[model samples]
Structures are given as structure tokens and as C-alpha cells.
Target: MYESFYGFTSKPFQLNPDPSFYYGSRGHRRAMAYLEYGLHQSEGFIVITGDVGAGKTTLVRSLLQRLDSSKVVAAHLVSTQIDADDILRLVAAAFGLPAKNVEKADLLLQLETFLVKLTAAGKRALLIVDEAQNLTPRAVEELRMLSNFQLEDHALLQSFLVGQPEFRQTMQSEHMQQLRQRVIASYHLGPLDLAETRAYVEHRLGCVGWKGDPRIEASAFDVIHAASGGIPRRINTLCDRVLLAGFLSEKHGLTASDVDNVVTEMREESGPERSVTPINAMPGLDSSALARLMADPAAARRLAEVAAGYQASRLEARVEQLEKVICALLGLGANTTDGADQDKERRHAG
Candidate 1:
């Protein structure tokens, strides 16, 4: 909604990780450098640990974007507390192989064959496992074993492990000694600092063609960093809500107070359970009416159309304002030229 009002081509503060919007803060840059070093070695495990919402996934996406698909075959998996055998199957599936009901031996054989084929085609295989903290010791061991697969002296498969900070603790366990031995590079991604936080917000907004509409005050940035603790996802959530608030209030500039209001509202909504009725639970909203809306396809379509129409109207208003400003400036220039011409004529007559 605010995207149109702010003249953005796309939603900049979206939650999903998009490689195109990656911001290379100090920590992220060091992480990327370690990842690049891992790629150059082309063997062993590269462990990247970070706090929740520290942009680990975004960093991985950015790395994948820079890779040459023809030379690199990459597979990604988010761990689900699966056992060792299940993890092997998941890896096989990530590589586009059928793993259903396959025996453990067969799964390993299939994976080896696939990796060998990729190697023969002059492509290296990169396996990225996210949420590694959820993986049991056995599952992690399976990954370590897979890293042992090689052709002659060159390793066929390289693994990159990404997870929350607890994963670093997991790696220190006695059971993880072998896996630790295979790690060639490791880095801990940290939250953005104050300066980086400001840069990060500007970078994302700039990506969507933000031209300072709903201009944000410097103090607002400080408030956002304080509220979000410099976490990328938290910052996105706060900024998105703040922008919505600005739109509703018809504000062309945002202050720290705007951010504080939104943060307070969000906290209240997420606070402890209360006896009072929820604000969204309108008195007239009957169960039947809600069920009908949910069941009816046409109702959903109409709701979408209504939303689109509202956004279109907002964009139209903004465009009209811009046009008016441009025309006024042009008229002023014309008046100045006419005044100069009149003065010249008076001088000639004299």
C-alpha cells in the first residue's frame, strides 16, 4: 500500500530474502569472504553461524546468485530434526534424485553416482544445510561422511552449514570433532551496527526507487535500530509498519514518534492475553459470514480487486500532486521570461 504512495516499483521491506536486496555490512562481507575462500578450496565444511534474522539466508542467496550454474551444482535444505537416514534422503531429493523408500546403502550409492556425474561434467556440487541446529548428532555425522566423497585427490562434494548461534555450540560437542576437523573456514555473522543499520535501510529503499518520499528523519533511524536491535528482519517489520502508519496519517515525512507509536501498538497486540475482545473481531462479523467469505472464490477475487483499486487511487493522487508541482514550476519560469521581455520592450521604447 505504501509502495505506491512512495513511488516504489516493489515492496522493499518484504520479509522474504531476495539476493538482489542483499546489503554487505561488515559482518556479512567477512562471511562472504570466508565463503569465497571455501569455494576456492572446493572441499571441507564451511560453517556460518549467526543469531536469528541475522541475514544468513540472504547471504547464501547472494552467494548463489554469483555462482555459475554450469560450473556449480548447488542444493539447499532446511533441517527438520530428521534422523541420519532421513537427512541423506533429503540431500538426495535436494539434488533432484528420487529417494522414496530407498535403503540407506542405495541412497549413499545414488548420491555418490550423482556427484561423480556432476564432477565428470566439470561441475562441483555444493550442499547448503540451513537450520543446522535442528540436526541431531547423527544427521550432522552423515553430512560429514558425505564430505568424504571424492574423485582421486579432488573432493566431489563441498558442504556449507548455516544455522543459529546454538549451532556453534553444537559443533563444539565431542561427537562433532570429525566435522570440526573438516571445517576449512567459519564465520559468525553479527547484527548490523548503527551506521550499517542506516545504510541497510537506505539500500533497500533505494532498490525500489525511493526518492525521499515520506522522508525519514535521522532520529527515526536511531529509533528503528533500538527497537529492532539492528536485525534485518526486525528492521523490515518495523519499517513496513511505520510506512503504513505514515500512509494512514497522510504524512510526507516520518519522525521517531511515528516509529514509537507503531512499536507500541505492535507490542500491545502481541502482549499477554487479555479478557477484552480483540479489536478486529467486529461485533457484526458472524461466523457464517466469515465462513462464506472464506469459501467463496468470488469473494476473495472481489477483496483482491478492492485492495488493488485502493492502491491505484493512492498512486493516482501522488502522480497528480507531482504533475501539479511540475506545471507550477514551469509556469513560474514562463512568467519570469515574460517579465524580462516586457522590461526589454520598455527600454527599447524609451
Candidate 2:
């Protein structure tokens, strides 16, 4: 709705990861370099860990977008908490190989055959496992086993493991020593700094043709960066709503006050406090325990992941309601556009 009002060619702050919006902050640049280095080596695993919403998937997508199809065939798999057996099937399916009902032995053979064919064609196979934290040790071990595929002294497959930060703990455990030994490169993507946050917002807007209309004040970016903690996805979420507020008020510019009001309204409506009474009490989260949980990195990442999943489930419902309201407002706007419709139609009919 705001896109039309703002004369934007696209929704600049969409949640979906788009390579076109990839901003090269210092950390992201380093992470990208590590991924590229892994590509050049063409073997083993490359591990990338980041906090939730720190833009790992966006980084992966950007890499995929730049890949030369003639040299690399990449398969992306978003994992859940599956086991060793299921992980094999998921990998097979990701590469477009039939994985149904086949025994583990056949599955391994099939995958090896496919990889060998790709190697023969002068293209190496790249498997990108996203949400790697959800994998069981055995599942991750199975992934490591796949890296053993070789022909004529050349490895047939390479893997990239991308996940929330806790996955680093899992990867460093005793049982994972072999996998760790195989890692050629690894990087942790950190959130953007305040300065980069400001640039990121403008960069996204510029991508969709923003030309100073509905100008965001310098102070507004301060509010945004603080609210988002310099996380890209959170920044996108808040900026999207801030722009909506501007569009609703028909304002030519947005200032810190405008941003603050939207942030306040959003907290009241959607913050975890809305369910805290039940979440903290009925669900058995005492104050001390809650604090401890938040302090623990693994627990915090799990909570955030679960909360994000719950929020995503509600997105479709929200989109439907928003669309209905927008359509209604559009009909009303059409009627009121020029004094309840032009009289030219009636004159022409007469």
C-alpha cells in the first residue's frame, strides 16, 4: 500500500532475503570472503554462524546469485530437527535426486553417482545446509560422511553449514572433531554498527527508487538503530512500519518523534509482554530462571527461533487482513478522488 504512495517500484523492506538488498558491512564482507574462499578450495565444509536475523541466509543467497552455473551446482536445504537417516534423504532431495523409500545403502549410492556425474561434467556440487543448528549430531555426521565422496583423487561435493551461533558450540564438541578438521573456512557474521545501519536503510530505499520524498530525519535513524540493535531484519521490520505511519499521516517527512510513536505502538501491540503473564507464569518461567535462560546463548537462540517461527505462522493471516483493508480503502479513495467520481460519464451517457 505504501509503495504506491511513496512511488516505490517495489517493497523495499520485505522480510524475504533478496541478494539485490545485500549490504556489505565489515562483518558481512569478511563472511562473504570466507564463503568464496571455501568455493575456491572446492572441498570439505565451510561453517558460518550468526545470531538470528544477522543475515546469514541473505549472505548465502547473495553467494548463490553470483555463482557461475557452468562451474558450480548448488543445492540449498533449510533443515529442521531431523535425524541421521532423514538428513541423508533431505540432502538427496535437495539435489533433485529421488530419495523416497529407498534404503540407506541405495540412497548413498544414488547420491555418490549423482555427484560423480556432476564432477564429470566439470561442475562441482555444492550443498548449502541452512538452520544447521537443528541437526542432530548423527545428522551432522551423516553430512560429514557425504564429504568423503571422491573420484580420481578429487572430491565430488562441498558443503556450507549456516546456522545460529549455538551451532558453533555443537560443531566444536568432541564427536565433531573430524568435521571440524575438514572445515577450510569459518566466519561469524555480526550485526551492523550504528553507522552501517543508517547506510543500510537508505541503501534499501534507494534500491526501490526513493528520491527524498518522505524524508527520514537523521535522528530517526538513531531511533531505528537502537530499536533494531543494528540487526538487518529487525531494521527492515521497523522501517517498514515507520514508512507506513508516514503514509497514513500523509507526511512529506518523518522525524524521530514519528519513529518513536510507531515503535511505541508496535511494542504495545506485538512485544513479548503481551503474553508474558501466561508465558512467564503458566508456562513456568520464573523471573530468575527466565533471566538465566536469556543469559545462556543456546537457550536464547532456541527461544528466538521458536518465537520467530510462531510469528511467521501468523504472517499469512496478517497479510490477508491487511489486503482486505487496503482494498476497502482503495475503493473509498477512488470514490473520493475527485468529488465522488467525475460527472463526465453521466454527461457522455446523456
Candidate 3:
């Protein structure tokens, strides 16, 4: 809603998965490297785990988009809660084989033939199951069985299991010893740091053709970092709401005060402790202390620049404290000016 007002060609904070907005934080880049390596080596099973909204899906989407078409056949399965037999049918359907009403034996034969054909044609097949945590024991077992399809010396079909953190727990279960052993490579996507959070915001904005320096107060950015814990989806949600609030008030830039209001509103709507900004107010920390940095354009710019270069966790902590103090001082200045204005108004009325 605030796109035009902010001079953006498209929405900067969309929830949809877009590779253009993918920020390669250390964890993300490492995961992608693992994915790329797995694809090249024809690894048996690649497992990727992360917390909810940690961009697992986005990473997978980006990986698939870069797959070598001439040498690899990639099939993505987003539904994983089906029974073992249905899992077979889903895999069959993904490769354009006869799946509906087909017997298990018939489906397996068809799949094996397809894999053999792909191998003969100088290509390999990839089966990517997203949300694998939702898969039942039977389904996971079936997936393990499917991994058995191999040539004399090489695996024909490579499988990737990607899901939220629970998927890791599921894999680590004693019952899944076989499956766990089969995972040739695995990675857990971690949260982006504060510097990454800033770049993440800017990268998404740039992707949507935002050329103007859309002002988000420094204090507001810190609130976003703390609230979102540097998760992309949470950042997007807060930003979208913040932009809407700006639009409703006919403003072009977002102030620290605006972010404070949005954070409070989010806390009230959602449960008090949820990390993801609630669709409604959830309990959120006050970020008004960052306002002073935002009031001065140069200082805000310098803070952003310094944050970009800051790589140590300890140093970041110190800088964050300094930023808060500056904001508090600025707040005091504003309060004093406001008090002076009120005194003048009282004298005139008297």
C-alpha cells in the first residue's frame, strides 16, 4: 500500500518466496553450498533443517532454479504426510509415470525404469521432499526404501529432505537410525546477524526497485532485529505493517515512533512470547530508545555503515548500547522542547 508513496516499484516486504530477495547470510550460503555439492556428487540423502520461517523453502526454491537441466531431473514434493503407498504414487506422478490406481510393484518398476533411463541418458534424478517433518514413520521408511534404487556402483535417485527444526529431532530418533545414517550431508540454517538483517532489508527493497533512500529510523531497525531475531519472514511481517501505518498517516519515511507503535500493536495481537511478530499485538520490547539515532540523518547513516563493518558479537553488543544512549538523549531534548512549548501556551491562556 505504501509502495508508490515510498517510490518503490513493488512491495519490498512480501511473504512470498522470491530468490531475488535471498540474502546469503553465513548459514544460508553454507546451506546452498551443501545443496550444490550434494547435487554434483549425487549424494544419497541431503537434510536441511531450520526453525520456522528461517527461509528453508526459499533456499530450496533458489537451489531448484539453478539445477542443471541437461544433466539432472529434479522433482519437488511439498506433500509428505501421505501413507507409504501414497508416497510411492507421489514420486511416480512427479516423474510423469503411471501413479493413480497402479499397484506398488508396478509403480516401483516404473520408477526404476525411469531412473535407469535417466542414467543411461547421462543424467541423474533428484527428489526433494519439503516439510518432511510431516511425513509419518511409514512414509519416511518408504523414502528410505526408495533410496535403495541404485546401479551397481552409483545411486540413481538423490533425495533431499528439508523441513523445520522438528525434522532434525525426527531424524535423530532411534527408530530412524537407518535413515539418519543415509543422510550424506545435513545443515541447520541459523538466524542472520544484525548486519545481515540490515542488508536483508535493503536487498529486498532493492529487488523491488526501491531507488530512494526509504528512511527507516535506526532505532526501528534495532527493534526489527531484536523482535525478528534476524529471521526474514518476521522482518517482512513487521515491515509490511510498519509501511501500512506510514501509508495511513500519509508519511513517506518510517520514524522510530512509528516502529514503536507497530511493535506494541503486534504484541497485543499475538501471544506475549512468540518470536514471529503476531498478526496482532504480541508482547514486544520497547525500541523507542533508538529514536535519537534516526532523528539525525548523518548519524543514522554512520550507524548503518558501522554495523555493516562490525563482525564480532561482543563489539555489536557494545555498539547497540551506545546507540540506545544516543536515542535516549535525543528523547530528552524533544521532551524539553515540548515542555517549553507547553509553558508558553499556559502563559498565553493565563
Give the alpha-carbon lDDT of every model.
0.77, 0.77, 0.74
Candidate 1 to truth, TM = 0.77
lDDT of 2 by residue, 1-350 (tens): 89999999999999999999998988999999999998999999999999878899999999999999999999999999889979999999999999999899999999999999999889989999999999999999999999999998999999999999999999989999999999998898876665687899999999999999878887676556645656788888888988998889998799877876876677668764421111121121233443344344344333333332333246344323332332243334554333312333443466
Clashes of each: 0, 0, 10
Best by TM-score: 3
Candidate 1 structure quality by residue, lDDT tens digits, 1-350: 88888899999999999999999998999999998888888999999999878899999999999999999999989897878869999999999999999999999999999999999999999999988989988999999999999899999999999999999888999988888899999899876766687899999999999999979987677556655656788789888888999989989999867887887677567553311111112222233433333233344223222221222225334323322333343334766445545644665587
Q: What TM-score fits each model? A: 0.77, 0.77, 0.78
Give the per-residue lDDT of model 3 (tens digit) for 1-350. Answer: 68888778889898998886788888899999988888877957999998778899999989888888898899999974677868999988988887989999999999999998999899999999998889887899898998898888888889999988888888887889999888889999876666677788878888888775467765566656655656788789988888889888887677656775786677657643434331111111123433444444444434433333332334434344444444444555766455545644665587
Off by over 4 Å in 1: 272-350
lDDT score for candidate 1 against the true structure? 0.77
Ranking by TM-score: 3, 2, 1
Superior by lDDT: candidate 2 or candidate 3: 2
